[model samples]
Target: MTIASTLRLSLYGVALSAISTLGLIGCSNSSTDTAATTENSSAADAEKPAKSIAITQIVEHPSLDDMRRGIIDELADNGYVEGQNLTVNFQSAQGNTATAGQIAKQFAGDNPDAIVAISTPSAQSIVAATTTIPIIYTAVSDPLGAKLINEDGKPFQSNLTGLSSQLPLEPQLDLLQQIKPEMKTIGYVYSPGEANSVSLRDSLKQALPARDLTLLDIPANRPTDIGMATRSLQGRADIIYTSFDNNVASAFEAMTQAANELKLPIVASDEFSVKRGAAAALGVNDYDFGRTTGKMVYRVLNGEAINNIEPAVMNDLTLYISPKHAKTQGVSLPAELLKNGINVDEQAQSTDNK
Candidate 1:
């Protein structure tokens, strides 16, 4: 071979060796960067602590049940999905106030990220049990009178914040008046021990007189007594009126049965009650009330201070009428009110079958 050809071949060999060495170094750097990124991701996942919350309700009524469902569904929508990054513990007091108190103590001992109390009795129990655990209560009426907050509805110096179902009494009365035109006595069936029920009853006493009507107060301490309490109002009361009481709500079927037997119409303060069997309701939807509560909980989970959130009252009212229930109770719905009603349930199942 020529000498010039041999020199060129040697130069080509050196260039190929340098290119192979650069390729190997690039692969090593890429692999190291990938491994470091994986490690960093793992460390970040490990540093994130799992969030948890406990929910307690006073009873298993449909209204309260819908509230619970709304809360869970809303939380899932906010990215705190259950069984993923969030842990939700739920307990129902089963219409027993003593059980509610015990459940509150148990949750307080667990010291979860938050405690959601539904209904006034459940909220009061949790409030008495813990002063530090953040509590977001729903379906409570008259939070100010219940001492959950000040008159201004601020959770100042307290870890209490929630949505109130405190419906306006006068509007509800006006709805009854519009239905019966001659309703002289407004009969109320509720549990006397419930703070919300008692508050509502007191408010009704003042509001009833303005419409030239009297208030008949019937007390049912437990679910079993609902029928008897409602029966007591049969002859004396011109019509039946129900407040948002957990105990009475648990056995609302009994109230419906009593009303049916007496052929007396019922007007409830909660839309769910109307859907269940009451003749009508001019009130708040407890599920929406709970969604508002879940939003508050999401804010707290996102590190917003609980004390900074002022207590809220539901402003929107939904008018629901049940033509089926009205017919069963010997009442006729006003066409004008029916036109404005958000919905009319004509096929609601009877309380006996439910």
Candidate 2:
């Protein structure tokens, strides 16, 4: 009786052991399948290439820097994150035309997915360097004037598109008149090599005469030459006016210093310069301008045809005035000017003589 009961119990134990072994084997196969699926999924993800963008600018000024920042941030927000799924290679020309030209060639050689040129000179250089690389330019006041656009009023077929910050000269000129009603001559400081500045200079030449004002052309080849260029206008011109010249704006503190010493008022076409110490500034918002260009870059990178994208023109205007600078520059601010002004206190604080 004991042998029979013991055999039954032993057989029952063996059955339970077999069931447990089968369950373990089934669980092992399930786990292995799950790990293999995960590995395959990760491998597929790794096969995807990260988007690449290269940004080149004429100089490292606040406005241009703001534009760069806006582009990078907007790209990240849209989906192309730096070091994550996107790569951004940024280079600054440091206010040198030759250097800008060199940078453009280098970028052309590397041949990134897309190129962003920040200013007029930068855009022109890149344009001359490559015809196949997709390009987006910002802060260029007049793309048409710069010859970046074709006769048909569009970006060259498929290669280029960007934002043009072409501001109206009338408001800026009228504002100058309001500041100095007796202003007979305007000292124009700019770099002739820059297409944007040259366009602005030509505009001023035509507009100033109609307003009974004279244009005194003062050329600055580089940022270091701005102080002298500005000082030269002191006695020859009644008031100083500046174009959105990258060189002049990069060395704007020097321009402000010379104007302060000469007791001459300066009104700038670039609103960034006003925040940097010009008595008044009226132009496009540089940061937003960059963001706009960035969205276009996203489109080109996402397989959208570049030619289909229309070149952007920024007609929005912003006015910035520093009361302290206005008084120092011997400029009287009109009530209407103040009402439309955007106080850039932080930018002004950085512009102090330091």
Candidate 3:
């Protein structure tokens, strides 16, 4: 009677053990299936392409416009069409710093892939607006001085890189001497708010003494002040020097008019300034500056780290001469310089009838 009861209990225990083992196997299979489904979903998400990038520019001036065009052109060439794989948002500050800052903030709000700043102010504003969005700046002079980068010209703990329009000042100053050997006092006009302009002014002042020239500072805080500043320098300066100040550039016509009235020849940092009224200017082409900026944007947009990219400088600079202004101011350029001039012929023809 004891053996029969013991065998029945053992059989019941074996049946329970088998049932538990099958239940464990079923649970394991279900868990494995769930994991496989999750892995497949994750792989699908990983294969989906990322969203298109949004790019913003600070202002809309001739130089900045050229830069924007260059960027779009490059993007198109790379198959990142504006409406397709890329979304470009271009806004202009119209020379207003506050407006630029607002635009920067707005661009950052949209979480753009990158921001393209055209000038120093724009770049600074963009940098102030965001610490993460990549920035590509063009036509900025002395990014270090502008506080847009570290002294090494590297990104300052953020994603920022671009080109600097710091053309060699030596050649420009030498041209001044060539055009007006007796020019003792050269009047220079710049905007104080511009770090690049301030830095350039210091360089010019320090270099002028060695050339036996005195740099007369004509400070114009805004575009409207340019006319008065140019008038103030009428008789005080034998020649006028201009920097790539946005304020001054915006009112170059007024300054050039005053200089022409005073028979004061002008030398500028941009060829377009020379075309307006300056006697001569040595500068890189704005279009090319824009093109180089575009290449930087391409690199950054194509997955390269902005911090790892180095700032670029234009390789070629052209000498531009205004024959009309030259004749009016009684200045003559070297024959070689005239031959290589970018806008001499048109200037001469326009002046011939005048």
- Models ranked on TM-score: 1, 2, 3
Q: Per-residue lDDT for 1-354 in model 1, tens only?
A: 211122112111212222122111101111256878656544443344568999999988888999888887666556566785689999999988899999999999999989999888899899999999899998887788778888655663478888876665656777788778887888888898898888888888887776788989988888999999889886798898887888878899999999999988998867778877888887777777677678778777757788877676664667778878888998888886677664556334344457
- lDDT by residue for model 2 over 112-171, one digit each (tens)? 999999888899999999999999888888788888997676886369988776666777
Which residue window of length 10 is worst by lDDT in model 2?
A: 21-30
Top-lDDT candidate index: 1
lDDT of 3: 0.71
lDDT of 3 by residue, 1-354 (tens): 211121111211212222122211101111256878656544543333343454444445465566677767655544455664567777788778898889889888988778888888888888898889888887887888988777665677467777776666667777777788788998988888888889988998898888778889888987889999989986789988886788888888889888888888888867677766778877777775665566667666667787777665553567777777788776777675566677665856789989
The alpha-carbon RMSD values of the candidates against the true structure, listed in the order shown, are: 21.4, 21.9, 24.2
Regarding TM-score, does 1 or 2 come out ahead? 1
Say which prediction, candidate 1 or candidate 3, comes out ahead on lDDT. 1
In order, what lDDT does every prediction score? Answer: 0.77, 0.76, 0.71
How many clashing pairs in candidate 1? 0
The local lDDT score (0 to 100) that residue 155 gets in candidate 1 is 63
